[model samples]
Target chain A: MNALSTTVGPPAMSRRGPVSTGPNIPSLVGSEPQQRGMGIARSRLVFVVILFCAAFFVMAARTVELSLKKAEPMQVTKQHVTVPPVQFTRADILDRNGEVLATNLGTSSLYAYPARIRDPEEAARKLVSVLPNLSEGHLIQKLSASKGYIRLQQRLSPRQKWAVNALGIPAFEFAPDEERIYPHGRLAVHALGAVNYKNEGISGAERYFERRLSDAASTNQALRLSIDSRVQYALADELESAMRVFQAIGAAGVVMDVNTGEVIAMVSLPDFDPNTTRGVSGNQRFNRVTQGVYELGSVFKTFTLAAALDDGVVDFSDGYDASLPMKVGGYTIRDDHPKGRYLTVPEIYAYSSNIGTARMALDLGTEQQQRYLSDFGLLRAPDIELVEVGAPLFPARWRKTSTVTISYGHGISVSPLALVTGIASMVNGGRLLPATLIRNSEGWRQGKRVIAPDTSRKIRQLMRMVVTKGTGGRADAVGYRVGGKTGTAEKASNGGYDRKALISSFVGVYPMDDPQYVVFALLDEPKGTKATYGFSSGGWVAAPVVKNVILRTAPLLGVAPKTEDEGLYKNVALRIEE
Target chain B: MRKIVTISAAIAAIMSGVMVLLLNIAVQEQASLNRTLAKQIHDDREAIRILSAEWNYLTTPRTLEDRSGQFLALMPLRAKQIVNTPATIPLRPRGQDVDTKGASSVVLSSADKPRKVKKNQRKGTAL
Candidate 1:
């Protein structure tokens, strides 16, 4: 404790006194302390030099220790840490570009302890001051009751919560709660789905991905779907506008990546807001693209021709007579606008000759038609990540009659999602990819081979022919090399077809020279319009919708435009005149 | 003389021990500061989460389209009008003097364009 134990004396004292009490060094050396000022100065100088050398050695040793030691990351000790609970109950749903589609927004639920309230009248009065919606007389009765805990309000806005806090009612308690909110409001309602009072996913994607959203590992990171909000909005806007113009009962549209089968956008009209599901009609809640199967009239012809061409039953050069109504058993098939003579394969398609397509189907045979439809994924509901998918309705027996009617899209019904998925297969180099709503961040999906690559090229050429000089001329977007078909299927009634109620649809692929996207638009029971000259066909109603969507989304998709004069597809020569 | 040598070395040893103690105190202070900084980072991430939801709300396609439709008379972009890069459009003829008129017109055409886009445009990769 005395001068003997000091490691280093204070700076002022070390100048004149011994720096350390290390076993009396001077006494051990047997030296006398009889030196003058210069002797003391020289000794001090020696002390300074040794001090610097000692510091240098210490720093060198520490450096060696650091370099030699295995580099360990500095760990913020988590062994005994009491972590806070997860703030939100459900994981957020984002679009492909990371735009939040659905999220659990936080709110405070106001509750009160009836036993703790000193003045029932004053407490109820104070509570009503911030929350004017609560009945004052009712609150007075509930607050005065002997019940232990009473709920005053289920949800309160941040401003209301702050104001209620300012009231400073000791009996009141605020429980942190969250509600599923879709701030985009009806934008992708059919895709994201809705949640119930307990925040349980009830329908749509919300119901489908319940476990993933609640899973602790994935609750922090958002669930990203393959929907692009911009593309989705453009598609929906065009379809809705067409539906309004045509006075259709309902409308549905779908857009997908041809090669990947990633559904970029899907819209079903009369869609309800996911935020508020109460008082919504079943029709409004229905997802027509995935959940409502309808006989999509002439769009089915593309499949028949693809099947016939791929199976070598017919080439692009071959065709059938459309002058007479071809009869398959008892059913007679006639073209909507007959050419009154022999129709070429391209003419049959461009003019939408049902007889020609039915004849092609007969050549392909019933078994081959069924196999092709199955391979195209049109026989079953699409394999999308939603629980609301509708099973396709088809004839149980594959007869010649069934084949002929189905050839022109009459004998069976399939969801719009299935039709678009099938069209994607026909043009995506003949690979039939299972449609997906989830984003495949990994890589391109490997699809099953449905048709030969050469067949796909020919189909693309034929579809371009339809847009350039056929029924789908309305959908021929300039510089896009648009190619598609128009379908106007009379709705099936009690043992007969109702010609008045038509399911007019157009399924198309753009930049046909190198197809990337397939767009399908359908209007249900569209009454003939004055502008359309009382014609409610797919070409009049849905083809223009598809064209608008392509024009709007092409810039967003960054597809470089080519001048119309650019003769890029000279290899595929199609003679429209013949 | 040996007594003085012994004393100087001992003094150096004692001084280094005191310096080591001072260094230990400084490290302790720094570690506590790091803990505070880490807490701030955690809180900031949470804030960003809430803010992102609000940001998306204010800028959803429907909202942005409606607001822009009201405020700006800008027409929708067309495929022909878009050029992938500036290099694709030559600034001017190679050796020609800077055409002030042409340069100003180019700037005027693209006037009021956003200087920066913080929004993540989801240009999805091919499957």
Candidate 2:
């Protein structure tokens, strides 16, 4: 055992000492060759370790690059397949009070493949017996057409569908479909808008939320608007009455929340029934509240006064010379009432004096006036949810004449919606929130401040003075404290203004101390009547409408009427002498 | 010992097979119940949708206003008619304050008050 151990130990120690010395012993072939093989194995092990590190380094670098890099935009190419179309069930539209304004009603429509029908005349006779509305001649002609398919009836009641199916006629089939029905008929036609027979939204709020309304997954959820149905009905009723009494060609009105800018009620008279909008006149479909642009005369005076005050150029007590008409660039601007005396700023607003307003605009100049109007969101199209929003028309060149005329609301024209939104901003603590049709949309928008709070208070006082003593006296609802400005503009004709045709409008804000709502009423081309003493001015035609609307809607909006003394706004009331 | 283990394993196999067959039957029955309940829920939802539409149609403001105008004498409540606080209500005069608490009915008019009987008259004879 000792001899074996001694021989193995000495050889092992010698081999370890020169293991890396490759092929050093030339004579001892077996032992040295084995050592050389061990050296090659050790070198291969180091090479493998280095290779592993290099691979790991590449992976780490790629991971870092991927983590820090921005992802590229994804593009999806369209691919078409000839499968049967899936009919969409639309979501219902509800008012803020959870009253359903629009809903999808299930219906069945009859169609026949003309080429496949065995007997067209016999089928027509059977169908007409079931559906008395369809003329037998028309049905026969449609069923026997050379076309591939023809529709016999668009909307059939369930009983009618069953009756036709009982006929057992070949090639005739009832296709299940849905119709968008506005239950209130013409009550909210302009705001709810109308949808095509295919259940596709074509205009108004329907067109605004078309994607959300048509989504199948959202069918159970109803889209709630900011409008209250009771208030909408009252506003529409009052405006319709005023239209009938005044003998106007058309009328438009809007009620809006001052703080959130949510439109409560919008009415455009001569509106058609949304249920059957086919063959309705284009004039009936024209949404005057949002789409029609008119020079809303003395209402623009409110802006002129507000802008002058906001710029620190004038105050309520500051007086302007109005003894005579002021001439600007070959055009003379005069007050319709023509109070031939120097008038204070409040008197100018209350009396709607064109001479005084134009003089103030001259002092403010063109640049500041344009800036103030633009800040009021009058320069561009109002960004409302409705697709029928109109772009305001302004003069291309802001010359002195344009400034003067625009001050009295002649040269520039804007939709009723833009006017109300601008006034809402002026009175609502000077915060300019864009008018919205969507409920709870205020969470996303932090309104931009356009005027100072002090200026807004002063403007409210002057507007109240207008209703109490000036041109808008008819709009003063006793306890409601209705404050507004009256505007009457001559409709523009071929290169001149027509005196006989006028656009009368009034803008009112109720509970003027802390303004909550803005009500605007406008009438187009109203004829003079004995009740108005042969006058079709804003004070006579439009102010009464504003008063009636405020009186009826204030209670529904949870606004309480105050006593006469309490109704007087707690601000510096402007005392003006006629 | 090997034979005993084989016998026990065979017995276990047969018992487990029977138990599995029983569990499968129970699961299938529960699945069928779930399917039936799901169908009932779907049918109820469809009925609710139709009923809601009909309710809206009946309660539309225009229809309600017209119907009320035709049949009922009720008008929209005026601002003057709405009294928010109890303090605004006029107080009754002395001797007119009736005990209304815990009473099912109260006499609103002087004519509706109960008549007092005379001392010499009998109650049944007056009728």
lDDT of 2 by residue, A467-526 (tens): 987999999886887889999999999989999999999999988877899999999999
Expressed as tens digits, the lDDT of each residue in A1-578 for candidate 1 is 12422323343444434544565655433444533543675678679879988998999999999999999987767422333444677899999988899988778899999998889999888888889999999999999988689888976888999998999888899998787778778887888889988888988888999999978677888999998999999998998888888889999999998878989998999898887788999999899999999988888998999999999998867878888988778877778988888887877877889989988888888999999999999998889899999999999988888988899898789999999999998998999998888987764777999999999988988898888778898997777779999989888899888989999999989888888899999999998888999999999989999999999998787666665533543433454453
Give TM per candidate.
0.79, 0.78
Candidate 2 segments whose C-alpha is farther than 4 A from its true place: A1-88, A113-118, A133-151, A168-171, A441-445, A564-574, B1-37, B92-94, B97-127
Q: Tell me which residue pairs clash in candidate 1.
A: A444-B127
- Candidate 2, residues B1-127: lDDT per residue as tens digits? 8578768978988898999999999868876776666666666666666777788778877788899999999987766887767677665322233656556543333333334435574433211
Residue B66 CA error for candidate 2 (Å)? 1.4
Off by over 4 Å in 1: A1-87, A118-122, A125-129, A132-141, A564-575, B1-36, B83-104, B107-127
Error of 1 at A139 (Å): 3.7
lDDT of 1 at A119: 94
What is candidate 1's lDDT per residue for B1-127, written digit by digit as tens?
Answer: 8678778979988998889988989877876777666677667766777788789889988788899999999988766676655555644222233345446542323323234323573221122
Clashes of each: 1, 0
